[model samples]
Each structure stands twice: as structure tokens, then as C-alpha cells.
Target: MTVNFNARPLTKALIFRIQKQNMHYSNSKYWDFCAPVAGILLTLSFAPFDYSWLALAAMAFLFAAWRGCSAKRAALRGYLFGLGAFGSGVSWVYISMHDFGGAGALESSLLTAVFAAFWALFPALAGYLSVKMKGPGQVILTPVIWMLVEYLRGYWVLNGFPWLQLAYSQLETPLAGYIPVLGAYGAGFIAALTASIAVEICRGKKRLLLITALTILWGTGALLRNQTWTHEIGQPIRVSMIQGNIAQDQKWRPENKINTLLKYKRMTEEHWDSNVIIWPETAIPAYLDQVQDAFLAPLANDAKLHNTDLIISVPVQETAPVKNFNAVITLGKEQGMYRKTHLLPFGEYLPLQPLSGFVLDLINIRLGNFTPGTATQPLLKAGGYPFITLICYEDVFGDLSVRGLPDAAFLVNVTNDGWFGDSIEPHQHMQMARMRAIETGRFLLRSTNTGMTGIVSSKGEIVGQAPLFQETALTGTINPMGGMTPYARWGDRPVIGLMVVLLLGLLGYGKVNVGRISVTAV
Candidate 1:
């Protein structure tokens, strides 16, 4: 068949323009497909990459994808974005599950996908509810809902994997200034709100108003960044953080136990001149009761003789319930103990007792059957300095980490990141520790097995750091500081209160706006 263009000139031009416009519209429809890339951008905005501004751009893309989309479509878009975000960011989970847990390659990949997919539901819910609930004021309401989901992600899960929270990316950004006053959740809310404004700017909506709001938000952060929220209460104390660099595969073997104990002992003996020395979590591979007579008692005597204090992590047993605790204890100065309260599901304890055997067989690590500790534990002390003691991943909980508050002078986090091997988990873990310092206005002395042993200042700066995967000790002088940051005194109550008020106000305004539009239409 031969096609002929015999139309008049004006009519042909109109048809061509219509076709061009339709083609442009067709091309624009694929923006929603960009959600995966948006997720990558979001992931890179955090720890290892440190390109923080990409977070805003990523969220802007998400907002555009979700705009005018149905709830189901929005959920799909959000899920894809999450797969990209958590799939890449928390990819270290696979290392822990496979490299350390003895899972086969296929099993590890599937497990990681499931974990990421489970958490993806939070953002999916956020997207669905944002469209469902935001009757008129979608921009502001969307981010508020997003923050609500972020809060739930840290609260309602099996304990919580509160990693890669939006505020964490801003630890070096001016937005971190809001942490002392509002806490990380509050800062995250602001970060998400800023991203929402960026989306509006992209859509060419309320440019002047959004610009002014952003200026005030960032300017306030800039002003607050230099303000000191906590003060030094005593002289600087010399501290040593010992990194044993024990491989995960070798740590728990019966034959390697004695040698591991001797290695830590030798390192401790060398560091006794320091005022305080810390050993990483489960650095003793055995229960405190088992090691007390053979190991700890002798170490205690040596520490006292040298006028030094030692804090060590061990498993502690309780007789009545036959439960075990992932605990830290001190010797020679302030004798106190801190048991880990926030436990990791499956890794620390099985979700249900019936499936424990099967779960262990599949995961293949010697998972701990730990009982959660009470929150009213005493503040641990070392070398006359009261300390907020955190074990392993517990420092990820900002509110829990600061519970000891103004009473505790500084913070100490002891971890064993050998489980994740030479992966990004250690780097991200260190980043979270720095944020904890910023939130509480206290220096953090972190000791880890196989990396990130360092001292972080109250301002979230890593003042001293040891090389990763090394068997070395990091020594530094840390001042015992007093006075509560606004976050420590009030906790996250103010931020939660503000969120409640804002959500209610937005819902009311949306109702009023819908009513007015309805009346105008009639």
C-alpha cells in the first residue's frame, strides 16, 4: 500500500504538532520506571558514598513517580525504590549470612531479597497512605507520612534495623544540628520535608515560598551547628580500644578458644598503662561464669595493680530462668555491668522457640539465645568517668543509646564486625556511632574486632581511627563531659509531639480544602 499526504498545509502542521506532543507525553510516562535508579541515588547518599545531596534528588524522583499514580502503582514504585535502596545499601547482610553464617550462595541471595522486601513494605505503605490520606496538601502530608513510616521501621519490626535513616546521611550536613534538639527522627523528618520541597520546585510549584522555607530550615541548622550542648566535666582520660582482628570462622571453635583468650590478654597487658582499656563485644568467646576463675579474676588483679580499668564483653548467665545475656562488665575502677537490651532477631534469639532448630540449621551460625535486659541498668564507669556502654549493633538505637544521659560522661560501643568480613557494614556501623556522638554531645570510643576502632568527638567527627581488619589498639584522650543535650533531656518526645500536631493540622486543612472545592463545583 502506498501512503499519500494530500492534506492542506495548515491541517498537516496541526496533525504534526499533535503527534509531537503525544510522543513527548508517551516518553514522559516512563519516569516511574526510574524508581530503581532513584533508590541507588538514595543509597549512595549515605555512608560509603557520602554524596548526601543525591538523597534529595532521589526523593524528588520518587515524588514525581508517585504523583498522580494509583495506590497500587505507588506501592509498586515504592517497593522497587526500596529494593534498590536496601538491596544495595544493606547488601552487607548477604556477607554476614553467607560468608559468616555458612549459607549457600543461592540461599543467601534469597534471604537478603526477602529481608529487603520485608522492609520495603514500610515505604510501600507510606506511598499508599500518602495518596489515601492527603486529600489536598499532598506535598507536606506525604513527607509527614514518610517520617511516620520511618519511625515505625525503627520501632515495630523485630527489634529494628534502623540503618540508613535519612538523618544519618546528614550527619556531616548542617541538618545534623537539629539532632541535639529534635533527635535523629526529627532531623529525618526535616530532611524528608526538604526533599519534598525539592520535588515541588521541580514541578514549578510555589517557588518563592518553598525557597524561603528551605532557607529558614537550613539557616537555623547553620546557626545551631557551632553551639555546644554539652560541657567537659573532668580532665581528659587516656583510653585504649583493642582490636583483636579474630576471624569469625575461628572465634567460636573449641580449639581456638584458649588461644583467642591469650591473644586478648597479651594485648590488654600491653595497654594496662592506659587509664581505661576496652575489648570488643564477645571478645571472650565464653560466658562470664566459665571465664571468671580461669581468666577474668587474674586479669582483674593485673588491672588493679596497674591502676587501670578494663571493660570487656562476655556472655552472662542467669540461673533462675537459665537465660543468657550479651553483657559488658568493668574491672578495677567502677565495677558495673551493661547487658544488651535491644536484641537482633534470629541472630540474638529466634522469633519462636519451635522453629529455633530449623532456623539454626539453615543460617548455620552459632546464634545466641539471649534474653533482653531491663532498661534500668546502672551507668558503667571506667577510670572515674561514667559511660554509656553499648554492645555491638545496639548503638544504632539513638534513644536507647542516650538513656543514661547527662549522668554518663561519654559513650563506648564495642562490636565484632568480623561477621560481615571486609564489607561495608563496618564503615556504616562507624558512621552510626558518630551520629550517636552528635546526638548525645559526648565523645564515643569504639572498639571492634576487625575494624573501625576509633574515637569520635561530640560533634560527630572521627578524631582518631585505626585501620580496618587490623589487630591493633587505638589510644586517645577523651574528656568526660557532662550536661545533657536537648535530645538527652527531652528525648524524642518533642519531635513526636510536633509530628502529631502537624499531621492533625494537615488532615484538617485537607478536609477544608476539599469542602471548598466541592462547594465551588456545585
Candidate 2:
């Protein structure tokens, strides 16, 4: 009798059962939706308040269901977890759209849900594959599979967002040392492994000593990177960052332009001793060339007179008909500019223009039809030192923000978080910024429009931090240096490659073992 394994009805029946089970738990029409939502809510415990580690706990529960449950059910659970995590994590996007974008509540909420659902697929696929994949332990290749999926989601989607990864929550932990080596992706792997190992131990697996010893490997991370990434190769440069705390509604208005400039000038003047005075993303409401040359001339003159570099955020117009963004423009240090490359969808420019505007306007900011900048390359040096520059939201992506480092003396992140307003968004924003410093072997100088602006060292230590919603001038001197970390030079390739190899090994082992079982039965 000829048998077709591909036609096996067992898998189909299992998947149907899983779909039904998931549908019963979730209110959504989609199957397995509950898992993603549960995962997201579970991750909240991992945030700053009290139960952040609970994020890992939540991940563990999902991992089991993925490894042992029906593949279809596992996939559904993964997507559900993603929905919950991103639904809450990126809720800030809705604020930007509804309150600022002019998109009404209902429309913005629906779009946010759609956005969350799209990203949730990353986890859903990872979960589904974990079942198809066999590993040494239950989901032993979990970290590899997770990272592969995250990398795909972050890159495959429109400009992709790698926000709210489990690694971001552990910015302060000793395991963070792995960030520079493997980038944030490596941290995710380690964090996931720890959680999975814990789950196995909890399930009465007698591998305590082995797992305990393996976790101890993180000690190497703490020891090697206990100190700062780079030493002061150059004298400290003084910088004054102005936080205007402007309301998002009035920010793009023509009438608020003068008030915005005056507010920043006031805060900036307070730190005349500063050698470098900076502003946040699009600090100037007008385009780069549109603002009176007189406006830029003085800042340039002041930069030269003070022998300092004054960087301001403004949109720049290009002959290409694209309005490029510097977000922060350096004055005095003429030619001092680091243009933003990665653009924000809907917020910066509409993705699909034909019907995109209608969809974007629903979110409501005018989006200015801004053009994307040409190069996200590096800092525009002045006063004899190289500084890396990353605009708002740019720092959240570990790869983009930390690139061109090691060559540069320090890093600069300019952001406008006023759109979020008094939400956990700012705190989390600051938290993610700190992780970038840890990832790159350099100091970071943040000049934000609203607050949480300050200096963070290579060790991810917050040397100086500004309070949220306060209009203030933060002046500090950050030591600039040139040093390299394993992460700075190699990027995520090594960690990801390790993961891929591991997954292959698991698959091979499973295939061989299953063959042996079949043979023995015959």
C-alpha cells in the first residue's frame, strides 16, 4: 500500500482543534489571537513599575504552548502575544496620530490595532515554526527562531520597527553586556534562553546545575564591560540642550514658530558656557532654507564666536522635490550636519500616497510632506571631535543608532517626545536610549524637545537626566573617546548566525531521532 505522508490528516485535525480552542478564548475573529494579547499584557510586568521580569515569565508560557501544542494553535498564540505586547508598547503611536495627527479616536485605534496585528505575525510565525522544528529541549532553538523572526519583521515591514523586544527591558541588567557583542538581538536570545531554561526546570527537568552554570556565563558580560566603553580621548565639550515642552497641537502651527524659537533661545542662553548647544527633532517648525537666513546666520555666528557647534533640528528642502530632515542642524560649525535617513511612515511621509494621505490624515499631523534625508552616516564634527548623531525614534533601533560608532567620539540623539505627553512613553523612551549607549562603546548626548534629555555614558549609566515636560536647559560635559566593542564592529551577524546554526542542529537531531524511532518500530 502506498502512503502519502503529506496527506496525513492528523496534522490537519490537530490544527482545526487548535483553531477552535483559540477562538473560544479570544473575542477576535482570528484564531490564536488570545496568545498575542496575553503575551503583550504579560510583558508589562517586565517594564519599570514592578513586574518586568513577568515579561519573561509570560514568554515562557507561550514558548511551551508553541513547542508542544498544535502548530496552528502555537502560531495563533504567538500572534496573540505580539498583538498584546505591541498594542500596549506602541500605543504611543496612536497618541501621535489621534491627538496630533488629527486622526479621530476610532480610526486611529483601529489603525493601531492593525499595526499591532501585522507585527504580531512575527511571533506567530516563530511559534508555528518552533513546533515544526525540534530542539534539544522544548523549544531549545527558541532564541534563534525568535531573533530570526524579529530581524525579518523589523526589516521586512515598511521601514520596520524593532520596538519592545524583550531585550530592551533588560537595559540595566548585567546581561546587557551581551548587547555590544550581539547587539540587542543577542540580548533577546540570552533573555529568552534564561526564561526557557527556567520553564524547563519548573517542569521538573533535572538540569538545574547545568542551567545554573550556563546562566553564570553572563558574568563574563559584567566583568568585561564593567567599566565605560571608551575613555576620554578628547577634552570634555560643553553642550546646552533646550527642552521647550511645546504642545504637539500648536507645534506645527505658523503662529507658534516664534514662541518656539524664543523658548529654545531662552533656555539655550542660560548655558552660555556650553561649547555645543543643540535642539531636538524638527526644533524649528520651518524648513531649513525657508527660515530666514538671518535666523541661521546668528546661530552660526554664535557657534563661531563661542568657537562651539550649535545643532538645531529642522526640515531641509531638496531639489529632488523631497524635503529632507536633519532634525538637528549644526550651526557655527558650518557644514555641521547629520541628516536623518530612516523616515517615519505616515508621520514623516505617507507610505502609499494615492490613498495614503486619507489614511494618514486620519492620524492628523499634516506630516509636512517632509522629504527623507540622504545620509544617516555620522556626526558633523566641530571643535576637533567626532560625534555620532541619531534623531528621535532612531535610537530605538539598536542597529541604526549605533552604527558609525567606534570611529566617532560620542553619540548624540535628538528627539521630540512632546507628542507622547506625560505617558509611560517618555520613561520607556529614556530607557531605550540608555540601551543604545550600552550597545555602542561611546557616550550619548540627548537633546529632546520635551524632556528626559541628558548624558549617558558607554556603560549605559545615566550621568545626567532631565525631567519630563519641563522647559529647561541641560548643560553637561561628556567625555568623548574612540573605542570598539564586539558589537560595534560586527553587528548582529555573529549572534544571528549562531542562532541559525543552532536551529539547524536541532532540526538535524530531530530528523535523525525520529528516523531511529520509525526504524525501531518497523
What is candidate 2's local distance difference test score? 0.73
> Would you give me the overall lDDT of model 1?
0.84
The positional error of residue 256 in candidate 1, measured at the CA in angstroms, is 1.2
Model 1 bad stretches (over 4 Å): 1-29, 352-366, 516-522
Q: Which candidate achieves the best TM-score against the true structure? A: 1
Give the per-residue Cα lDDT of candidate 1 at 160.
75
Top candidate on lDDT is 1
Q: Estimate each model's TM-score.
A: 0.92, 0.88
RMSD of each: 7.9, 4.8
